[model samples]
Target chain A: NAGVTQTPKFRVLKTGQSMTLLCAQDMNHEYMYWYRQDPGMGLRLIHYSVGEGTTAKGEVPDGYNVSRLKKQNFLLGLESAAPSQTSVYFCASTALLGATGELFFGEGSRLTVL
Target chain B: AQSVSQHNHHVILSEAASLELGCNYSYGGTVNLFWYVQYPGQHLQLLLKYFSGDPLVKGIKGFEAEFIKSKFSFNLRKPSVQWSDTAEYFCAVNVQDYKLSFGAGTTVTVRA
Candidate 1:
């Protein structure tokens, strides 16, 4: 059902370049999140949206921005890529916030900044 | 800020050996706990979760976890392990139903 889909499965950007990562969910969920996974460090939230037109900062929001103009899509943007920002990004969605519903995650987008 | 901890960073075991991975969270109030597994080159999949009732929860692949409120711990266990059980395991906590915080994952390697 394409529970969660992330675009640009892999990308390489030079320092100071900009790019956007797209996440789409067909689950009709209300909560969507962007997270980065690094070696040894599990998954850290970058940004999140409770619903369409609403977005909020997460634990690790530096160097990134997010938009949720539509309920099914959440976009994470890196205005200026940095070596530290090179990590695997994941998108997740849940039917409800603060509930027991499990998160549906995307395969992940691997970004490398040089 | 709330935080989650997974004590075992890397674990190796022989096939059929029992398994246990320790997880602890720092929060006093009510919380929802989750255990997710990531196989090689795959997305994170929920193994099990605990919401309100039943501290002992059983999940897929013959895995289970028990919630100990006093200890603020939710430890995962399996009676028997297989080579296919090798994967990275994560412990997550949902506080106030708003944000999910994840622990530094534990990598389990099972030798057949």
Candidate 2:
């Protein structure tokens, strides 16, 4: 079973361009999250959803928006990309949050904004 | 505000050598800890996690971590390392309100 899958494995966007990264999961999880991984910065939360149609800001939420209109998909959008927004984005899903259950992650989407 | 810290930015070890990567957290209340490994070009996978009960948790690939509440630390350890162990490891802590804080990560290289 495909636990979590991210679209656009690699992307390059010009400054001021827009794009959306899609995350899909077959685990039927209740929680989904978007995160960015930087060189020495590890992973920082960008946005999250507790369930379908709900989204919340995370640690590093600037320059990004998220939509969780469906139970199995979470979309992260960049309205206007910037050079500083270049990073590897990851999508994750969990059966439950605030619980001990583990989170399953997608391969990741590498974005380079030039 | 809770935060996670991984002291080692990079680590290199010979095959069959013991390994330890330091991870610390700053949270006062109850917390759940996790260690995730990201191979060269793969997704992040959980190595282990700590919720309650046993502080010493064993995970896949012979990796384990001990949660020391007093020191606010959950350190990952492996008895013997191999060339395949080369990867980037991350430590995270889930505090109140269900947000996870991750460390800067540690890169481990095992030379055969």
Candidate 3:
């Protein structure tokens, strides 16, 4: 079964351009998260959703918006991209059990802004 | 806010050499610790995790981590390393809720 999948594996955008990244999971997890991976920064959470129609801000939520319109999909959008936003974006999901659940990650989308 | 720290930024070792990566967290109370590995051009995968009960947890690829509550540390260890073990390792902590805080990551390069 496909675990977590992210779209647009690589993209290049000009400053002020807008784009959306789509994440889909077939495991039917209750929690989904969006994170950006930078060199030496590891993975920083951008946004998260506990369930469908519910979303929350994460450590690095600025300049990004997320929506859990469906149980299996979480969308992350950048209204106006900036050079600083050029980083690899990852999507992860885990079960409802808080402490015991392990997160499954996506292949990651690499974005480069110029 | 809680934070995770990985002691090494990069490590290079010969094959069959023992490998150890230090990880420390700032959370005082009960916490869940995890180690994730990312191979070249691949996503992060679970290396090992510690919730409760046994302080030493064994995971895939012959990797293991020991959780020391007193020291607030979860260090990963492998008896022998192979060239295939070259990858980036990350330490993560989950205090409450499902949110996790991650360390800066340590890149390990195993020479043949």
Candidate 4:
């Protein structure tokens, strides 16, 4: 069904470089989220979009930026790659189901910054 | 701020053994709880969720969780486990913001 797809599954970047991770979903969900997964840190939210053209910060939003110009796509960008930012990033979306919606997640993007 | 905790970092069991994973969340208001499972090299998938009404909720793969409001805990349990059940499990809490606060996760290994 191609529920949620992420581009550039793996990437290696040098410190101070920039890159963007693209998340696309065909489900047409209204809420989209970007999260980074690290060892022992679980999955920490980086950014999220409630709807088209609306973006908000999450728990770990310091080194990341996100935009949701379109409903089906959410873009996460790294302005300046840092070694501490090396982790696996995931994208997720959920349809409006009141307070009990479940998240559908993408495969994830693995990033390594040296 | 809302947060979730998974006490068991790793658990090892043989096939057909019972399973129990502890999960706790810190929030004063009403919340929606969820358990997600991630298989090796796979994305996270919902195992089950608790919204309201019944305190005990059942999920896929014969998994169930009980929501004890007084204890602020939502523990996942299964009567029997298979080798294929080996995966990483995570507990998450949503305080009506649509943003999930996830626990560190517990790794389960089922030996055949």
lDDT of 1 at A48: 95
Off by over 4 Å in 4: A97-100
Looking at candidate 2, what TM-score does chain B attain? Answer: 0.97
Q: Which candidate is the best by DockQ?
A: 1
Runs in model 3 with CA error above 4 Å? A97-99
| Chain B TM-score for all candidates, comma-separated | 0.98, 0.97, 0.98, 0.99
**TM-score winner between candidates 1 and 2:** 1
> Taking the candidates in order, what DockQ does each have?
0.78, 0.75, 0.72, 0.71
lDDT of 4 at B77: 100
Q: DockQ for model 1?
A: 0.78
lDDT of 2 by residue, A9-108 (tens): 9999999999999999998898999999999999999999999999999999999999999999999999999999999999999987667557799999
* Candidate 3 residue pairs in backbone clash: none
- Locate the minimum summed-lDDT window of 10 residues in model 3 chain A: A94-103
Q: Write the per-residue lDDT of candidate 1 for residues A1-114, one digit (tens) a residue.
A: 778999999999999999999999998999999999999999999999999999999999999999999999999999999999999999999987566658889999999999
Residue B104 of model 3: what lDDT?
A: 94
lDDT by residue for model 3 (B1-112), tens: 8999999999999999999999999988888889999999999998988888999999999999999889989999999999999999999988868698899999999999
Query: Candidate 4 residues B7-111, lDDT tens each?
Result: 999999999999999999999899989999999999999999999999999999999999999999999999999999999999999888768889999999999
